[model samples]
Target: MDEENQQAGPSAAAAGPAGRPAKSELVDNQNFEGQFKFGRLVVILSALAFTLFVSFLDQTSVSTALPAIATDLNAFETISWIGTSFLIANTSFQLINGRLSDIFGRRTCLIICMVLLAVGDLMCGFAKFVVPVTVLAGIAVFLVIPQSPTSQGRMRDKVKMIDYPGMFLSLAGVIFLLIPISGGGTTYDWSSPLVISFLVIGAILIIAFIVVQARFARHPTMPFRLFERNSAKILFAHNFISGVVYYTDLYYLPLYYQVILDKSPLTSGVLILPLILGFSLASAAGGFAIARLGRCLPVIRTGYVLWTAGAGGRIAFGPGTSIATIAGCLVVEGVGLGLSMQPVMIALLSNTRKEDRAVVTGLRNFLRTVGGAVGLGIAAAIINNVLLQHLPAGLPRAAASQLSVLLDTLPVEQRGEVVAVYMRGLHCVFDGRAAGDGA
Candidate 1:
């Protein structure tokens, strides 16, 4: 452990009433006045939501533009890297940013992240490269999110507060784990020594990271006590599933349009509009529902039900599915995501003490990012592996690898065969989520 580990745990004086928090902590509605006025809070959430939308839009837009990008760069095999790399960088520093936000304040973190995002976009525009752009975008999102009011503090030694060892271990663990999962069969064989080494090392580091959190960490990046309640466990699982479904859909739907339907990148993006609108509307509705009901579970349940239904519906799609049908399916999912997403955060706050809000929020977001990254990896692996195994007998490996980009150029029967294989992979992605939902 580093010298920083000595300063990891929160002081006992600040812990207050050991073990789980009391019901008094749950009296959020009664003592809510000191936070923000309902109207002002609404406005703040709206601003923060818009900020999130813009940042996320920047991320999703890359997927829509991917076919064109792969063609232009002649890097179709490495296209998955564009998204995975972003997710890796984004997820790696999540807890660090969460702690930093608690210390420096959300506004300061947002400004820094947004500025970095702008700089990253500018770099992409000039250089026409995606890796650095994704990295910058990842860094930009680290602080733009709204933390609970309790996270703001009067602490002066914020820099010293970071758990450097935990950060490194978690980052290494996630990267090592994700690289092989995402790259196996596509970049390297599953049985390759490189893959086995990464998997083994990643698992060990992850266990070490958990050990640090459980015992060694002074102020653990993710406190074990956060999962003490059944509600917290459920919410974390819910958030993780939502992350998987959300990212998988976001990344793959564009492919469905571009690859199966043979639409242009810009056209695919335009088509994704309905899903976004549904998401925005549903999100707003969730906020209103929670505000009126003074509880988040009902809305969350409704969202999950809708989300499950939407994922199930998407499995019905194929090469001949109508645009209207696909759009409708996306709308269903959008509504579900909107209704369920923010309520989880609200539920976490309702369940935890004010002091732990920042960490809880960080953990929630961290899981979601991890879910998204893992989902993308799984989706990529399925798509690549399936294509490798099932692409038409006559097509060369190189052509089949770039089949998504070159689908339209092939003869009609060849394109059909390729689309059939691609759709199988796409359907598998959705089906897995549907199964997860059912479980």
Candidate 2:
């Protein structure tokens, strides 16, 4: 009886013919030695992490260089496109890449993504316009990431596993949701029919997509069973909120250094290094903790505590805040980010059955991307609203409109007031993020 039960246990988690595992058995079953050589695992994960780092660096590193890029290219009017284009492409391609990874094998999809990302970055460095190049890079990154070890095999009939209907529905739904969130209050009015229509339509399509996944698809892109587990639902929410906190600090801290502290762009980048250092250390430590302990929850909770402390601390920042203070806060934020990021991903993968791993990976990324987009949009709205309501009436439209680049150039008498306006806007953005962290 005991032998029969033991045999029955692993069989429940075993992969079906199409390469997906049943939801009943989600625990790790493969022996470490049979699954991966330590050396090979190190090499593959290192490469995959580097690929993700480059993708993130492409996003975060550009802010410090933006002023120079705007001046050099004479494209200040279109500057927002550099980031927005990337976000749209990155968010949209996640599901498609997840499906492709399932069909073609994780290695194949990753290689294609890396090659495309490399080409796009190289082109951008050569003074090419960034929108298209960055869009392609974003698409590559969304595609090139790793899948679970169990998801590595090639299927017999890849065509059957590709769920075209679900893919289209998901893509359309996400793009619709993202378009309004990205463009509202920037390119169009928040209340405009263009925005409202897209929001409603996007919500409906997403609902429809979920229904179809539950009822119809021969091979549902997102297996409904994955979220049936309560823990998975909570994890997805955590990922979304983390995205908000991560990008808020990343985008704004450099501005604080440049605008409030009177540091040059190069200097600002250097100053942010402590935070990056903390992130690297904690990320490595967190990964080790997961491997050794075989659990992620403890590390994840500790990360939240640190992240909240660091993010909330920044709310007190003003024009006179010290670089030391800012640097310390950044370090805290970085450590929190590093600790939380990898463990959550590891946790998500661990909870999912083998066949669902790639899809869950894509879903995790999609939520993060959406969370980032929403956070940035809210920050932009707050900044713009504050600037409009508070800026001195006498300031030139050009200077007021392009506040970041023009603040230093304004007359000495007005420069301080302009700086104050910017400082207020930054405070709102930071405070909002802190509140999110606490929640």
Q: Compute each candidate's TM-score over C-alphas.
A: 0.86, 0.87
User: Candidate 1: deviation at residue 192, Å?
Assistant: 1.1
The sequence of per-residue lDDT tens digits that candidate 2 reaches over residues 1-439 is 8876566554444556554554322323333566878899999778888877887677677766666666677666666666667777888887667657766666677787888888877877775576677777777766766755323233545565677888888889988998788778766789999999999999999999898889998667788888988989999998888877676666667777777777787887888787788888999999998888878988988887888888888988988888789889989988988898878888887787665777788888888888888887788778877877887798743321245566657888898887788889888888888888777
lDDT digits (tens) for residues 1-439 of candidate 1: 6555344333322333543222212111113567888889989778887888777778788888877777787767677677767777777777666666655666787878888878877776666666667777776665566655223223434555667788888888988987787677667888999999999999999999999989887657787888899988988988887788788877888888888887888899989887888888998899998889988889988987887787789889887888898888889888888888878888887787665787788888888888887777777778877887998788645422356676667888887787888888888887998887656
Per-model root-mean-square deviation over C-alphas: 6.4, 3.9
Q: Considering every candidate listed, which one attains the maximal lDDT?
A: 2
lDDT values for all models: 0.75, 0.76
What stretches of model 1 exceed 4 Å from their correct place?
Answer: 1-46, 149-156, 398-401
In terms of TM-score, how similar is model 2 to the real structure? 0.87
